[model samples]
Target: MAASSLFAALDKDGDGKVSASELRGCMAAALGEEEAAAIVAAADADGDGLLDRDEFLRLAREADQEADEDGRWRCLRVAFAMYADATAVEGEGAGQHITPASLQRMLSRLGSQEPGLDECRAMICRFDLDGDGVLSFDEFRVMMHDGLM
Candidate 1:
């Protein structure tokens, strides 16, 4: 979610700042009073015991950085789904093995400047664990996390 939207949710009264009460209420299960106070203290640069928009955005950015691994997994899953779904056959569903032809087809459909079949084959080869000349979901996921998507 956008920082502004999240800030709005945490700022309950639309006061343009999040107090300990607001923070605790919105994230009660995630932290205790001491933890919440510590976070507010750390981010409340002005020492007013609250998080303003800038402070909140910075906190959100930091939190996102902390969740980087989870975020990468989410992106990998979504991209893999798109690639797998692109070549789904009638009534066959998505997530079938991805061959170079399927990868090239997906790239072409998404307006690649030039969907190189050979390049796709090489990519699949690099990650294809079973060596069946295609990529299973696990291979595709590993390749994606390796930033080759």
Candidate 2:
């Protein structure tokens, strides 16, 4: 979900592939013109224009590698939904509540590993924007769309 959300945001054109302008636009929308350009330069692996979906997804996956399975799932689902909603609409938008089914699935995905749960909870708290004890669609969208930490 987080991966999808982040990926969709990176794929600014909604054409399913990231372009230099789209990546640049998302960065600008998330950060500002100055910072966005810096980020694009950093993330633009081949510098051929923009980050392809695979490259962006790879970086996002790497960032989530340390998160708990539950937290990671929650993050991913919310991110996916938010990306859908953001791209579904246009311009800036507000947040929305995540579905109960999504929550249940997220929780169920949490493995029996206690260490994983502890680390995931910590990661969720650090990244959760709504602070409703879980990540919200809006929060994930903002994080992805704006690329703001």
Query: Against the hidden reference, what TM-scores do the models get?
Result: 0.48, 0.34
RMSD (CA, Å), candidate 1 to true, equals: 6.8
Q: Estimate, for each residue in 1-149, the C-alpha lDDT of model 1 and write its tens digit.
A: 89899899899999899998889989999988888899999999899999999998999998989799788778777777666644667676456678787788788888987558899888789999999888878888787668777
Report every candidate's CA lDDT: 0.84, 0.56
Q: What range of 10 consecutive residues in model 1 has the weakest lDDT sum? A: 85-94
After the best TM-score superposition of candidate 2, give how far the Cα of residue 61 lies from its true spot, in angstroms.
Answer: 2.5
Candidate with top TM-score is: 1
lDDT of 1: 0.84
